[model samples]
Target: MFDPQTQDQPLPQRLTRTLIIGAVVILVAIGGFTLIRDQFTEEEPPPPEPSAAPSPQATAQPTAPAGGDNLAQVDDWFPHSRTEFAEAGGVAADFAADVATIDYTRDDWDSHAERLGQWATDPYAVTLTTADGVAEGIWRALANDADAWTGSADVVEVTYFDPTSVTIVVQVQAEPDTGEDPTDLGEFSVDLTTNEGPGWRVDRAELLR
Candidate 1:
């Protein structure tokens, strides 16, 4: 509503008062509108923070077998090198196979003894030639009865090793010429020792079973 007293004022004073009142009304209306809008308006949530990426898993390294380092020291005090042990293992397996094999039609006791001696040390070789009761063993009996046999041997592993010797265990299988299935003669271990010449030779042999 317009006040009549305001019209009694001078024009400049009247104009200034009108402007001041109009400004005050405009500020009040703006403040009221802001408060009302705030009550009904929902504040938008802050933009979601980006999640961190997962870290990569570390790869596992292969662990060496136990006593692996000892292999490097194989020839330090040993009679043979690592390479020689491999050769000796093969020789031992061959000797074990020869011991298991018996062919009466092919080799006599003397010839077999000589063949065995080629791979054996003097002590072992002597036993092959003159060992009593060997002629009376099952193989000899089989040979006496006109039977022949064949055999094969596979090296299982080196059972014992040292500077002076290594013993290899083998699985021996034999089949008689009588159409029978091959017999598993059980395991045999051959001990090899460094001899006078280059490589290793069989010193002893034994049946595990």
Candidate 2:
């Protein structure tokens, strides 16, 4: 038969069980505190810093002016064709006459020199004569020695015509009173410009060959 008093656990065994229960309670409390701390804690945010604004865009530069060879602009400036052609032809004929016609006498030479001056631009006129006297020094020397010389020009064509300018090509012939064959002066090109005044004036003259 079992005794009721003896069925009770021993003192040492009861102390061991109490210690195990206390350890389990301590572990549960530590876990719950850790979870609560994590849930409530907040992280710090970074402070803002100042930034520079974008620089303003630079402006574009202007273009430079073109020097000479403004033919396109010149063409636009004068629109009339028939009038320009007539005026240019007349000017070219008068200039050719002035250049080819020279007399042995001083009076006739002076008149022709004056006409030539009127038919050329200031720059070219300077070439025909200086402030000292009429005609270049070399031409004056020839005219001084010669008894008689005559010349004429036949305008072959007026080409590269523009309102302000044109190219005059002509065949010039000359003869002396010494009774020699009429010399073929060959073809010459005269570039005339109307920029000086109302009438076309010679800017430059050159031999083609």
Candidate 3:
């Protein structure tokens, strides 16, 4: 009975402990894998970006000129100039219409005003009768705005009733003030006889309004 070889071995305590520890490790691994399965299976794609739109406003353009407003303007030139005889020769008699147009700020505006004033009274009155004769001659010479100058006022026509007598056409516009529409204010026939000059200026105008 006492033979060591024949003895019932007391359960190997160390071996039993090792087997229990291995069983615990296997159970923990199984639980962790079960919990992680759902996370590994699910997938979500990212969102897309938005697009931009275009603008609205349009581009700009230039303006055009008025019709025969030019004729209306020239219609004013003849009589306006008739008031002054001194500077009324070359440029005045020629195609000098643009005074109100191209020459507005150019040329001697003072001269224009001075001559215009003289036509009414003052030192200019000395030659009143002669001036009137010249103006009348111009009035008789020119008929209407149409016969005078067109477009840019590049032309003019004058007719003499007698050697020293003439008739001219004139137009007036109440512009830069009341309205854009121009009015044919009046046409005039001036009479004058002067020893100083054949064509003096309009001493006085006979309103043919």
Candidate 4:
């Protein structure tokens, strides 16, 4: 009688077969991931930015003269004398003189001429006309020089500036001469800005014949 016996694989052979199958599955999964990598990737670069611009700044401005400058202007008015500057206005005498006067008093003769000269010469000549008594008559004393300048003198002065305008004020001394002397000692001056800058002129003068 033949016994029924089936052939069986060895334990070592079975183990080797299972290991080979697992290695094959792992290799397939790695290859699949490599192929699909691009689909899972991020390709967008960050948005570009614009550069910033520069900012602006403020500039500086100039200033005016001092309380003494007006006196300096008056000083400029002296010396030229009525004969030399009959046309310049705002002289004190335009109101009183029958004719603009002349500075004929001996240069050594003290008082009016000396006082006025001294006062007007000071850039800081704000001592009060009653200080020299000639600030008002300076132009009148010089108007009588008929040979140098002529015509009726009008010591007219108008506001050249205003505190409302740039915080500075200017007064125009406009005296046109009358070839003769004024009857009274007519002299006057007005106080305005202390300094002389920013288009402000001193007591500029002129003579006409």
- Judging by TM-score against the true structure, name the best candidate: 1
Candidate 1 wrongly placed segments (more than 4 Å) = 1-38, 41-79, 106-108, 130-146
Tens digits of per-residue lDDT, candidate 4, 10-127, equal: 4687789999999999999998988688667858888788776666666666566566668657745544333323322333233223123234342323343434333132352333
RMSD of each: 7.5, 13.3, 17.8, 16.3
* lDDT of predicted model 2: 0.66
Instruction: Supply candidate 4's per-residue lDDT for 22.
Output: 92
Q: TM-scores of all models?
A: 0.59, 0.48, 0.26, 0.24
Quick one: ranking by TM-score, best first? 1, 2, 3, 4
Model 2 stretches with alpha carbons more than 4 Å out:
1-80, 107-113, 130-146, 178-180
lDDT score at residue 24, model 3, on the 0-100 scale: 96
Runs of candidate 3 with Cα error greater than 4 angstroms are 1-160, 192-194
Best model number under lDDT:
1
lDDT computed for candidate 4: 0.38
lDDT of 3 by residue, 11-61 (tens): 688999998999999999988887798678767666666656667667766
* Every candidate's lDDT: 0.76, 0.66, 0.39, 0.38
**Model 4 alpha-carbon miss at residue 25, Å:** 6.9
Clashing pairs in 1: none
Error of 3 at 173 (Å): 3.2
How does model 1 fare in lDDT?
0.76
Give the lDDT ranking, best first: 1, 2, 3, 4
Q: Least lDDT summed over 10 consecutive residues: which range in candidate 2?
A: 131-140
Predicted candidate 2 versus true structure: per-residue lDDT over 67-175, tens digit per residue: 4568546646654465676666666655654565556665455565666787789888766665333233223544643556566667778767665688878776656
